[model samples]
Target chain A: MITRRLPPWFVNALLVPLASVLCGFVVAGLVVAATGSDPIAAFSSLFQGAFTNQDAFAETLVSTTPYLFLGLGIALGFRAGLFNIGAEGQYYVGGLAGVFLAYSIHGVPGLIEIPLALAAGMLGGFVWSGIAGALKARFGAHEVITTIMLNYVAFLLANYLIDGGLMLAPHVSTPRTPEIDANAQLPIIIAGTRLHFGLILALVAVPLVWFLLQRTTLGFRLRSVGFNPTAARANGMSVGQTLVLSMGISGALAGLAGIVDILGVSHHMTDTVGAGYGFDAIAVALLARSNPWGVLPAALLFGALRNGASFMQLDTQVSSDLISVVQATVIIFVAAPVLVRWIFRLRRQQVAEVQITQREETAAV
Target chain B: MEFLSHQDVVGLLAQTLVTATPLTLAALGGIMCERSGVVNIALEGIMLTGAFVGYAVALATHNVWLGVLAAVVAGMLIATLHAALSVSLMVDQIVSGMVINILAVGITGVFYRNYIESSGLAGPDTLPHWNIPGLSALPVLGRIFFQNQFVTYAMLILIFAVHVVIFKTVWGLRTRACGENPAAAETAGINVYFVRYINVITSGALAGLGGAYFSLQQIGNFLPNMTGGRGFIALAAMIFGKWTPIGAFGASQLFAFSDALGSRLQIANVHIPIQFLGMLPYLVTIVVLAGAMGRAVAPAAVGKPYRRS
Candidate 1:
């Protein structure tokens, strides 16, 4: 059945996301039009806002930084057959922990203070998500429900701390923590823009995660447990330990995202710090099909939409929420690749897709 | 104990029932969906859609019942999409559910900002409270049980009705068969897809009514994400109840009690931080799931997509 065609990898990796993105835009445009705005004008403004506008591209990269880490975090969890729905909470906890570290310490070199704060954030996320992982491992608790429940708790905890409790800065008009020390903040990489050195850390994370998933025994165990926990257990791998470690690593990445955002951009935590980004990362991971490399473009697309949304709203008077519609549609198409194949009239590659889903079903149970 | 007077008990119980209304309805819906072997984390989104549509329709027509009907239809429509994706298209149910949730938030937010927020029209207001003539006069019991809004009454009745329908009927048996072992059910002449489709859509209808609790019954106007995390809380209640209609009702009451007690403590100027009180339900859910009582197992085939070879 071999025929002259583009490689299956090319189609699955490249063509699929590209077509899904197109379908997402089309669906989003219809929504915009239904809301009595010109979709063309809205999309055009959205593009300009994301790229062509002054320093907009840089800001888009800034947004991409968090999505990059969050997407990678969630994707890693998916690799371990766990759905980490509490990334938002993990992010909040990370910020709380990282910011506490950032402001509490006295004079030190930026180099010395930055890594410590980042580690604190990662530790926070790891601990928070590890609770769910431990529950899942020990008691067979479903991570989905536990993680979501934890998200709400995390939000409340963050709100309590920053709003008027321990972390609140004195003499501030608004409820937010005091600004971090000058040494703790990440230096801006680009002059005249908000882009900071965390982008380098985020960029480094991709290949590092790729290496971790591809070339490491831990990665193999995670993938094996995700593929079939029963078989992995039968093969002498400790499924419980793998689940815990997978969740811990996932949370650590998300924590990295949260702390990076604090050190790089905001420099202080607020109640609304990680509000919707955590949920959006779920879509990002879905779009990436839980592939670490795939997360790059997916996160970038989401970052662009997020960065451009406000400008789109200002220009076309279309609500910024329209971007979520686009994200949703993109994921819908990604999740049902059959629909995409049918729509594009591509050759049916049913076997691989079905096998992947079958494994997912087994893992899900 | 001294601060809790007779009137406070009655008021607290009444508030507990009021808070339980939406959680119970949505949990009942979760029971229907999951019992038929489909995971429906999209209840939150469906409820949000129902709330928005219910409020919008009620606002336009100035008729409350029509709004309730519209919410049900809207929920069913979204569930149909879920069915198409997860059941027919063989998409992962979780991914499909998340998509529906995001779409609901986006669509509802866009519509709410564009039309509802700026309409300047007042909502028809909460569904009329129906007072039981003789029971309404009773000292404490009547106030806590009988006097209520339309949805609360329906919720009370639906709990009993759903309990019977799930446990004591032929359709119930088939649905459980589908959930537990669809392959065996199909071999024995059950249409697995049909049962799942019907149950999932019906769950949407129930959840839609739950949404009306927010917009049409409790508040006159719809707010973006006003369903908040209640839908997720309901899912927690569903698991806490072990996927049974009656059990879900009990779990919803427990959650509602915590919520009511939290507000009560806040009013009473309790020394504990309010955020800690707010964390009670979620923390309770984690504790429950972590096997405080025991592991509450789900339907065997709940999260799996069935395929007939």
Candidate 2:
């Protein structure tokens, strides 16, 4: 009967977010009440909306795909001590690239067409993120600030493309690109469902990421640099190169998510295509504690929360934007773990201290 | 003929200078905080709050200076919370600054919805330009500077004062000391936290004034998120100018020039794609930030909280 110290594992994984979910629910409740809505009905509607039917499930899956991508991108960067805040921009550029490539080469063969579109998206992300990496390596530009500013630039560039050069659709009223041919689209998985093969790819990425981080030398180098770049440098690791490489990889993952969006969900590129996923991904990655394995549950939770918000609003008259509030609260809680751990640790410390004093008294006796 | 060309350029330059007034003020505030060891990324939010409060308060009181005073109070109040979190709790500077920004936006949005959505007070009385009579007659300079509103004059005074205080005063030296190396300064008996507190709050007040310039002086009403990333531009300017008040002001002028040029290009029908041209400031930020990498170094102990532990 190896009862092993399961407390550590449980506390780290389950308790923190479980506590946050509870707090989030309470905040949501207070918010609902503030708006003269019933919390119980709103919450019920939230749960019902998120899982009410197959269509809702499909929407959840659709939303989950980008979360998985951005989550993974952010997770990998955080693990490598590289804060890639530019994934939103990467997603934008990557989506743009896939659209540009798909439209640019229309007559490509069937088998290779989808792969080409995907690779283009990945390349788009790779090139965009590579700039930040190169700068961080060559010139020591702070990735955080540079990446953030680049988000605006990417947004602007996307505006440029959709409104001008890449305006494939004739109407062109909105800032979005033309839809690719049916062949370029991702094949739908379930019959009569909006769910696409992106879910399959995201799931596949989970294990692949786990393996890459755990089993490879590159992973070791990344982790070492993350822990202490100076030490990693002394040990012959090229910190700058690693920074750049990891950024490209991060961008590639985010870009792949964009490819999924083009071929799977929206089937076209638009100004509001990514829809704040990049910023939300930051919250998701941080809440998940930047763990790849941990991202699954975190993404699903956020997916459900986001998916249910519309119902919460429609049923209760509460602004569904309360979702943003809860999301932010969860991140704040996660960012400061010491605040949570201190409360629990206090009791344990008191008990242990008492035991030590008691044993000393007995010895004196 | 040469004199005419210079005069033409001076007229253009004078207009550019007039347009740059608000930017220079805000950018100056940005430098104050960045140099004093706080990022003050919420300069945009602080400016927005000041714009709304100043405009609304002045509109209610029928006094522009009172509105400006109200904006100062509002800005100081919000900055106090920023001070509490950053200086007292020692939270992540960027994260806290961003949170302040979001909160300011949220609060203002809510208030505007409540107060202005169905009300007439939303359209406030504009501040009249304070004419320096002789300066107003100085050909192109008169139209640009003297013909401008009071806020522009205030901004110029503030810029001069900032340059003097930053370069000449002992307090400024201590503030710079805190930003550069708080530990060594702390060892020398200067309270790092205290100096940072003053700087951050003062920085907040200056940013508030910048906001007043926007709503009270320019548009005359608080449109939602009117700062429109100008605060961030000011931030870029701070880095571009190598963290000096004057240098940052020059960067602000450059940004204001680009914005003016971008608008002019739209009007003049330049061949540059509208989207690409619209992206000028953001794109420039990326380029400037990329180039500023090694050249601009933040204060060594700027983000680190001073704890004995």
Report lDDT per candidate. 0.88, 0.73
lDDT of 2 at A308: 86
- Model 2 misplacement above 4 A: A1-9, A21-54, A107-111, A166-168, A190-193, A272-274, A310-321, A341-365, B1-22, B49-70, B104-122, B213-216, B274-294
Q: What lDDT tens digits, residue by residue, belong to model 2 across residues A169-255?
A: 777676567878887778899878888988889888888887877789988887777767778889999988887888888898889
Q: What is the TM-score of chain B in candidate 2?
A: 0.91
For residues B224-245, what per-residue lDDT tens digits would candidate 2 score against the true structure? 6777767777777776776777
Q: What DockQ do you compute for every candidate structure? A: 0.63, 0.22
**Model 1 per-residue lDDT at B303:** 81
User: Per-residue lDDT tens digits of candidate 1, residues B1-309?
Assistant: 655798888899999999999999999998999999999999999999999999999999999999999999999999889988889888878878888899999999898888888778876878988999998889887898789998899899999988888899999999999999999999999999999999999989999999999999998789988998899889888888888888899989998998888788877877667788778778877887777876677888888889998
- TM-score of every prediction relative to native: 0.96, 0.86
- Give the CA lDDT, 0 to 100, for residue A300 in model 2: 81
